[model samples]
Target: MILDVSALLSGKVDVLEFDYIIPLLDEEGEATILPPPDVDFTSGIHICGRITDNAGYMALKASCEIGYRTACARCLTDLEGTFCYEFEKIAAKAGTIEGDEDNYVMITEGRLDLDRDVAEEVSLEFPTRFLCSEECLGLCPKCGKNRNLEPCDCANQKEIDPRLAILQKLLENQ
Candidate 1:
């Protein structure tokens, strides 16, 4: 999906609006973000926003919405949600604005690959961690029990270094 931003670059168009979805699947129909192998990305990733012809540069601002069914990152609790992430990326032609080139999505020959560009932005801007709650007690590392469901004392014991284990043994004997 290549977008012709020529008009916006020429200062003839004030804004260019866009709304579309990118299927979160590869050629084989498998989901994009995988490994859990159960995450539901059937609805695909939706991107909707506008490109404003600012006084000097074009501002590409958009929001990405992802709906998925998966387990919590820390605890293995099942959950589902529609997450929205908002981001703004500058689109400028070569040598017009000065500074770091990486800051802006470089406009090449007045054309922009909207699909690829927006997808990159979505991946970079979206949150990787999907938690059930801010203070969710995850599973205990030693006991492999869900701390939220089953409280454990495994977290209370302090791990001693091998060199310090001798001192701990001496204290225990005393």
Candidate 2:
């Protein structure tokens, strides 16, 4: 996962290949999901695009895909899906370099780790919600039952305003 850049800095153009499984982590460094899922990452990083003393900076490009199991938004059932993303990173040897929101990575001491970078990129692309089916009827609010199994008569019940009900009750009592 870690690639040494001494040769590239010494005027050599080498493409390093890396493939590995990365573990997803939450903000606190704890495993984001229990039974930690595996992520597949593959990429070819260039020590230098062209061999030259003036080879400015190293270029990194990687592709990653991850499978996620999440609860359905409507019915709360488990749903599985695959997410794929591509990343391009640049390592500057001269001064400090900053990247935009989508493409951002830092190289320190002329070394870079592809597995870590790819894992982070893939994690950022995870979907917020998952759905088993688009047409899920969801659960009934009144009876707290699943609406997909059967239609409840509560949906057809007429609603009376509280004020009207009170007036009707008073008239009947009189």
Candidate 3:
């Protein structure tokens, strides 16, 4: 679950390889279909990259693929997508990184929690919106029905002001 980067700092390198199912719980500890309920996350990482002696920091490159299910924002259909991210991390203790926050990964007590890190990165990679299809017809507002399943004319009707009723009739006849 975690690897001590302190060992790498001392030239005693160690690697972390793990596969596990992580629960996606909401603020109320309830399961959300937005990210599905449970997901299997497998990670095979080699932390063999160098730990700078002068700074007692690690510069490691990680390549990982995380798969999860997310409901389409428009169609409310379950869709699965894999997030593949390869990034270089300069890991150090939380308080050590001064100016460049983007270049650092915080290790608590010299231990890097790979599971948490992978989840964070993968979650961040998720698209802001998921669509079942590019031409998907969304739900209807008036009847609260899925337009994709059944087409509705209510959503396509043009609204006219009450004051323009007489003018609308004249236009309709024309």
Q: Sorted by lDDT, highest first, which candidate order results?
A: 1, 3, 2
For TM-score, the strongest prediction is 1
How many Å off is the CA of 95 in candidate 1? 6.6
lDDT scores for all predictions? 0.71, 0.53, 0.56
> lDDT per residue, candidate 1, 64-159, as tens digits?
887877777778799888867887888887567687665577777988765655556555655555778867777665666888898988646788
Off by over 4 Å in 2: 24-57, 98-104, 114-120, 149-153, 159-174
Q: Write the per-residue lDDT of candidate 2 for residues 1-174, one digit (tens) a residue.
A: 455666665556555455654555534686533323332222222122221223455566666666665666665666666666666666555347544534445555767555555555555665656566777766554554666777776546678556655653553343
* TM-scores, one per candidate: 0.63, 0.56, 0.49
Error of 2 at 135 (Å): 2.9
Could you list the CA RMSD of all candidates, in the order they appear? 7.1, 10.4, 8.9
* lDDT at 155, model 3: 40
Question: TM-score of the candidate numbered 2?
Answer: 0.56
The number of clashing residue pairs in each candidate reads 0, 0, 0
